[model samples]
Target chain A: MSERTAAPAGQADGRTDDQADRRADRRAERRAERQAEEGERRADPRRRNNRAWLLVLPVVVSVAFTAVIPLMTVVNFSVQDIFSPGDRLFVGLEWFRSVSRDPEVRAAFVRTLLFSAQVLLLEIPLGVLLAVSMPRRGVWVSVTLVLVALPLLIPWNVVGTIWQIFARPDIGLGGWAVNNVLGLEFNYTLDATDAWITVLAMDVWHWTPLVALLAYAGLRSIPDPYFQAAQIDGASAWATFRHIQLPRLRGVLTIAILLRFMDSFMIYTEPFVVTGGGPGNATSFLSILLSKIAVGQFDLGPAGAFSLLYFLAVQIVCYVFFTVLTRTGR
Target chain B: MADIRLEGVGHSYDGGRTWALRPMTWTWRDGRAYALLGPSGCGKSTLLNIISGLLSPTVGRIWFGDREVTGVPTAGRDIAQVFQFPVLYEEMSVYDNLAFPLRNRRRPKAEVDRRVREVSRLLGLEEHLRRRSRRLDPGRQQLVSLGRGLVRADVAAVLLDEPLTVVDPAMKWTLRSELKQIHRDTGHTLIYVTHDQTEALTFAEEVVVLNDGAIVQAGEPSELFLSPAHEFVGHFIGSPGMNVLPAELLDGVVRVGDATLGRASVELPSGPVRVGVRPEFVRIGPAGAASGPVARVTGVDRMGAYNLVHAEVNGHPVIARTDAATTFDAGATRVLRFAEGRAFLFRDAVRCGALEPLDGRAGA
Candidate 1:
């Protein structure tokens, strides 16, 4: 593009050098000004406010007791074979190896991951669609906001119970619709595919409103001039959304995607209540299986190892995705 | 380029109860640069929106050349606008940002490429074309916004809404001149809306000044400066503005109160009038020397190039711009003289005429 410039080569070069010098001078002046400000701040007597740190001490100590200490205790338990609180044998690496090698655990891990992936794929676009179609202003805004938020207001276990009864082939409204209206044999208890579909659908129904709400908030924050500019530029509705609305949504969508990923990855309650880890192992997420090991069988050592691994997996994926998604646009 | 003509264009946000812009007939000549200048809430933006078709005027018809486009959409109006803050597709590269409008219209690729490159070169944004528009500084982002408008060869006019508001002061001169240069090179009619008098006066061939949703004056910058049509225009167009002192006009003698200032010989109706004077045209002298009203010097402000001598004439405060070397003690007595043929008399806030001879004797 620069090669097409009409300016004489020598003058352009001179102008470039002049601009570079001016920019460097401005940057240096700004740095000096910042340093001067910092020096003044340091000399200010108000900087010696030591009591503010003390005000935060209670929160820090409570978090340490509740989270950090228990996490450290879990790390300790993961490496030991504990029959009782005092009777324990240090068996490092054994539990970790067995947990990693366990076929049931491996299958559950894959199943949970697949569930999260499908949840995101189904929710993100659907949520954005719902948000786009939602009224932006006037009385309808409050009305629609209340309507879309109704599903999110229900408790997770209640959602599970409602769907559990609702998807039953014998008498429930949804299951009966599929069985008689759609004329399909759709018993979740008898078929693995049916169970998966029911669990996925229930999760979508319960949580999609969350994504829609977040996307709606994001859409509202964009100022009016952007849309007006797009209209003046002869952009179609799709073009306006693709160029103006979607690009500005990056910040909030990043947050929404991260929250949804973390939430879906750790999801257990709704699926557990609805399918109870399924007729087979179809819906046995890692959390449900780990609950069986830890609370049901009371195998503290193996459960500790399983939980640590689970925590590590969630951490790695969330961190990697957060970094990539946040930085990719820039 | 198409000449824009609006006949009785006006807007009312609350149906027809109140108008943001009062209906006014005006014509914008093709290839001529114009400015809609006013204070905030003066309906300049509303006028621009109406012309650009973003708004439909409550009462009136509009035309672009010979075409009646009062009911047309903004895109169909074939005009482009740059907003106060830079609006860009943050995820798109500067090249794509420049190409967006053309691509949206499904223009031929070759024409899009040519026009995009031409606009980038024009804006000095050639080197930044591949960079993400969001990553650039605000000034450059504004340039990309302007480029998106300029990249279309068929654009009839470009409207700017305080485009320099977000630009750094150092870059304002460059961007402003770049806009002027674009106007010169392409000859697209440009209508800029700004509350800034400097931006309007410097960039436009004609400035339409608005006050209280009404057209106060629309003329050349020099005309607005020298021969302001309304008192509001006089107060708004200049830095430190034109001074307006209330006085009585009777029997050809202009008096601030009981003190006589000067006499006007022109056929002027005798009533209350405002004596308007630019600070630059006011001359100060020792008391009892000049043939004018005696004033007490309140203070002197040295403003680098000139000194502002603040004084009071018959309890009315007045500011006189003098040479920087001049100084006066506070509370000193001085006579204020209005330069011959420069001071004007305004009856009911409308210009009556230039102040006539200083001698008390009326001309035959």
Candidate 2:
């Protein structure tokens, strides 16, 4: 402080240094005054506004009523054999052990995970490719956007129903075209492989547009000069996308991947509509099996156990995806 | 390195409706620095983009030395550009940023490394080479972008469009000198576009000033300062600019109100003319007993190096620049004098010639 208050010795006259010293001294005094006021403010809680917490009451109440209460009920059902709410008997952890050991449940878990993986793998690159190819301006931009977003606007069950009929070899044009045009024998209802492929294709078709639109929005936010710079740098079409467009799309793509992952992992409607857990349970994902156990067979306790396990898996995977994707995006 | 020649180049956004740049022929000689200076929307950036092959001219041809590149793409043109904003890949380290151009051209890994290191050293970015390009300050990011251009040895020229707008003031001086030094060291042709006269004057050997989508004047710094070819050049090139007052020309004698300013030996214009003088050459002295136009001092602006004494003569505004030691009082009256040969006469805003003040001191 003294060194700052006074100019270095022998460098200049003290008359100017006197002015410097006075200015520094005033600055120090102001700093002290600010510190004193801050100290008082810290010491006196009554002087501060503490009502900011009240603004969060609605959120707390909503979350408690929606997420917390339902979650606690699921937890309670997982540990009890309940014929009626008041006539319930505690069968601690028995449902968990049986459900965890069940071969069908284990297979469905793997199937769901594999489906999510396939969905991401097929959708992300295809979406990015579509985004990169889309028009940036002119009247065609609106047309292209509308066209790309068409698949996303369809109802989930409708998408499943459409694909189910569409894959029928006899009456559906798509299946007939595949069979007659390519000369490939294809039947989704009779073949396990065909059923799985049908469900996967259905998911990919319905979800890829979301990724593409997100990536397109990301690409749009980047300024034009980056592309101009890349062009002048002698970058080819692929190189430009690799260095400029792809990196710029990192944020939106992260969101896209997370949304796709969560949606695909928890997916039940589209596959259920199309495959109905399919021939010999080939398309029976975790959600479908859980519903079958809970609603069809009325095994409330085991279904509750399955629900918690599914939630836990989603939580762990989402956390990992959020961390890894955000870190790499940075 | 090669001369960039633009012949009859012009552009219009709406199909021959309104012009952004009128067709003109120009050549920037090899291994020299030139600045395209103008106000906003004066076609400076448009001209730069045309030269860089980012925007092809709607008419006429472009040549890089003997090679006619009128139809070439931006990537095909051997020119590099620094935009108004720094353009760098955020995910890449400074090393990769600098090596991007070379890598895009499929240069060998060793060669890319060598060029990256060399350019990074030139930009003083050696220490931050391993850091991501986004981590640097704006000035340093601009330097990295500049390094990307410099990394390619075969580049014909380097173009800059208001590259220093985002730099901090203190860093501006350093970056300007660094750019000048790099030009000198590399002997690469540089074309800089800016609205700032100081940046243009300091960085370029020649400056082309534009106004309203047309070239106003083009000349060396001293020529621009001493003998502006256009009234706009005089106004745009200097601090405080030049003061202009409406006048009439009678057989080459320039007269403003009742004062005979000077005479030009060139062909006389009987129509209206204007008297142009830099405030530095306009002198304010005590009135009375002098056969000169009197002015009423309105205000004095105290600049650090000088005082600007604004006054009115025959209801025409005139400003006189005096040293810091000199001052004038408001409402005081004085005789206005022009330094001999420093004042000019302009007809239709085009400079006619220097004026020979009728004052006898201009004789001997």
Candidate 3:
């Protein structure tokens, strides 16, 4: 087998073989040299200057244009005044003083704080209980979770509008049923206490599901081994929650609390539609007050200043919450 | 201290469509460490969960001491469990993690501190008390769970369910030994679950070998290793598994395809059966014997200390452990013979009481 094939291949050698072999060898040498050079290039780790930030430059610019620019404009307007359309005068802290002394602004601040606190206190525990009781699997779980999330998807204005008509004493189901069946006169438009309670109930109805959903996701994320370990440790149900479940859910719960607080603090649409911040400004939170100053009065100078201060207050609260919870590692 | 008894304990997952654990009875004495060993999905973890009151048996009763506590809740049962993954409060310090159970019971501060320190010393975690459990490595976090379970000695029992399955291989041996030492010192009725035979054999005094949700064998570790009652047990217990050869029964003699598989020296049943012999018992040498079965070498796998010689005998794969010093090229023909009385014969999958004297299904 070797002799027959070897004879033909050897016969074709001669001068062509010598020239072809040299050319092939040189090409091989050049290729090897190029590879070696490439290898050395890769080996020099310090030479690579990863310009990855360039990829996110567009995102940074977009955020600056849409968010940071407007925010800065508010800040600028807060410290200055336009005497007659475009003629500016710097008043410094005068607007802050005027807004702080205004009973309307003071009332809004207190109302916002009370609303946020009340929502947080009511929703957190209830949400956690609902989450713990919810089944972890099967078709029923999917259905229940989807249903719970339905209210969160409704637009704020629509939620307000729906509740407004539903709570009318003459025709609305809630007011009419309560008046007829319970024999009580509960009118949100005429009573401050009634308006406050109505607003709280609306906020609870609209947002409790969010906290429950987040808490449920947190519960589901806990590994089974933890429960097993707790069982072996002879821990009671409450102990398990305090020691294992609560700690594991801390990050999610913090986020939940912050989200609920921020949303409740800035709540305007629902109360505005339902009671128009009335029962005599009983539910006029800071957001509503800013809108009142800007749109109702059209005093852009003082209103812009008030809005900027409002933004700073919200930022400060969020920043403080973040720092305290995160730095202490709770 | 108490003895655990499971009488007629069995479970079905789909209302009897599939059984997760078959009818089984066993007794685990107080202060004795026991291991339920099996492969994954072999119902080892299920059994552990049942014993811990995390699962209820469809038909059975579990007793701790003289009391029938099968229907008791987990909180009332008093069994401490260490999970496969560490379940720690990430927000709490290791100190808090260890003290949580004691605090829940409203134990005195001094007693809590003493117990926590003792467990911390035992686990070498005293210095890490102030660190958050989440910041620790998975191994150390698991140790905290272990410490928590061990913190209360007055508890009924301690159950560990494959706790070392997630541990690093380098640390596995050390932790296994530590667990064994802890058991020895505490004298707790420990029921550990693991699929790995080595861990079960080394850590447990008696191993309950399970397969397909049934108790195939239960005895001392050596007994199960030396005399397995079922083909599954024999295959599951040993490191390399037993070599089973299909054979025909004729006039009380077992014939492997063509060649006779030595004498049982013990009685034999007349039927189609399998002859079982461990790879360690097989003798291999050059092909000039002119006796026993003639085998052609197929390949060799070099284990750390020995070579697993793979060979084909009459078209059947046979494995034998050859000495590290011996060398054989592929395709080389070699003669193989089993030790005189080591051959085990199985009818269907159950050990026939006739072969190898049965040995009472030792080495569980």
DockQ of each: 0.63, 0.64, 0.39
Local accuracy of candidate 3 as per-residue lDDT tens digits, A1-330: 999999878776756778788999999999999999899889996777778879999999999999999988877777777666668899887887898788878878988988899999999998898888888888889998988888899999899888887777888898788788889897888988878888888888899999999999999998887776676556688878877777777788889988998899889899989988887788888988888877897767788778877887888988888778676653
User: How displaced is residue A278 in candidate 2, in Å?
Assistant: 1.4
TM-score of the A-chain for all models: 0.83, 0.84, 0.79
Give the higher-lDDT candidate: 1 or 3. 1
DockQ of 3: 0.39
Q: Pairing residues by index, what is the TM-score of model 2?
A: 0.90
DockQ leader: 2
lDDT of 2 by residue, B1-364 (tens): 7788889999988898887999989888999999989999989888889988889899989999999999999889989899999999889999988888888889899999998888888989999999999999999999998898888988889999899999999999999999999999988999899999999999999998988778888889888988888999989999889989888888877777776666774777576888898998887767764555678999999988888899998888888899999877899998878887788888789987777755564321
**Clashing residue pairs in candidate 1 (N, C-alpha, C atoms within 3 angstroms):** none
Ranking the candidates on TM-score from highest down gives: 2, 1, 3
User: Model 2: how far is B79 from its true place, Å?
Assistant: 0.9
Give TM per candidate. Answer: 0.86, 0.90, 0.85
Global lDDT of model 1: 0.88
Model 3 chain A TM-score equals: 0.79
User: How would the docking of model 1 be graded?
Assistant: medium
Ranking by lDDT: 2, 1, 3
Give residue A280's lDDT in candidate 3 (0 to 100).
78
